[model samples]
Target: MDFFNILILAIVQGAAELLPVSSSAHVIVAEKLMGLDPTSPEMTMLLVMLHTGTMFAVIVYFWQAWRDTYFSSGHAFRSNARLIVVATAATGVVGLLLLKLIKHLVAGNDPGFEIEHLFANAKLMAAALAAAGVLIIASSRLPERANGALNLRTAAWVGAVQGLCLPFRGFSRSGATISTALALGSSRRRAEEFSFALAVVLTPAVIVKEAFRLYQSHALTVAKNGTSLLQLVGPSLVGMLLSFVAGLLALRWLSRWLEQGRWHFFGAYCLVAAVVVLLVG
Candidate 1:
């Protein structure tokens, strides 16, 4: 891909990744419009790097809040640590199971099947976007509940919902997880904090998985072309940097809207975007 194309994808991924609107959906559509193959190994590698950039943005933006909340005391630290572990465990189990089911149902006996093949499906992306939008709107409309401590049950619920987002491109992870937290009576502040915390935990695993998949699928091609893996991923470094900046800006916007009780507006935007994706994609 050219530098211009990489920059565009980076911007799209960076902004949309932090927002309730799905980044993968937007990135895939952008790739399609630019005549790039979303399922290609290089594109997958680029996507992983873009995610790494946003993951760092989450850390940078949330570091102080996390320190004050999760690390203020020994007991607080332990309790939050346990919650994170449980939630991450739940996410892994549910996400893996769903992935298995999807592969079984979609690929059947095909030996070379991979879920990335579905990343560019406009109909599926639209449906997933609509689902995420409804969930966000419903949660936002619920009556305000008292702010409560993060509990294991709520964490598990949030994680499970997050798992549901794994296989579906337009199903926003932050949107579903944060909405689940809110609908389960968590404060908006806590919901945002916890959702991003889970993101920080989950992203590394996803990057590793994508990297492995890229190697498995494209190692031969790279060898034949006499290209090193580093060479293939070199252009993505620029995209990562661009995405990091965009992600920081996006996080600020998301936080402001969430705090100002405009959370449902994101859902409305998602609904509209879904229609646009369907029409143009």
Candidate 2:
């Protein structure tokens, strides 16, 4: 990929990552349109860097709020810690089990078959996108409640839904978790805060996973292209910087729309995006 392609992909990754939309889905489509292979070493490395950039964005944007909410006092910190543990455990269980099942069933006897192989399936992406859109719309229409506390049951429910998003390319993690929390009667503001907190908590594992994939690809590409693994660093860093800027802006937009009671509009956009992906694919 050239500078221009990486820039476009980085912007898409940054914004979509925070906007209650699946950056993976959007980025994959963008890659296809740009004639870049998503599975290639350079592309995957750039993606890893993009995610790292966005992860930092999440931290920077939420630091003050998190301090006020999750770290205000000992009791508050303990309570939030319990909720995070429960939710993350639930997500881990669900995501791992589903991922294993998909690998076993979809791969059959093909040892080399991987979940990344499914990322480019437009039909699957469309279906998953539609599912996420429906969930977002339906949950937004539920009776609004004023509950501000995050309980164990609520965390479990949100985490379970998030697990479902793991293997599905177009299913948005933030969308599903935040919608599930809202549908469970959590306040919209609290839901948004907690959903992103979960994201911050879980991002490291995802980065490590992606890094491993990038490393494997690098080993192969280095032999063929006669370039050192370090050679990939410059482009990735540039992409990360671009994505970081875009991510900060996207977070602001998401927070504003969600607070203004316009969260469902993203669902509508997802519906249209689904159709577009289907048509183009």
Whole-model lDDT per candidate: 0.90, 0.90
Cα lDDT tens digits for candidate 1, 1-281: 99999899999999999999999889878887899977677787898899899999999999999999999999999999998998998988998899889889999947787777787689999999999999999999987666666799999999888888999999999999999999999999999999999999999988998888788758776767766778768888998999999999999999999988999999999999899899977
Question: Which stretches of model 1 miss by more than 4 angstroms?
Answer: 109-111
Task: Quickly count the clashes in candidate 2.
Answer: 0
lDDT of 2 by residue, 1-281 (tens): 78999899999999999998788889988988998887878877888899999999999999999999999999999999999889999999999899889988888747787787898789999998988899899988887777667799999999898889989999999999999999888998899899999998899899999899988888888889887767788999999999999999999999999888899998998898899899989
**Each candidate's TM vs. the true structure?**
0.95, 0.97
Clashes of 1: 0
TM-score of 2: 0.97
Task: Look at candidate 2 and give me any clashing residue pairs.
Answer: none
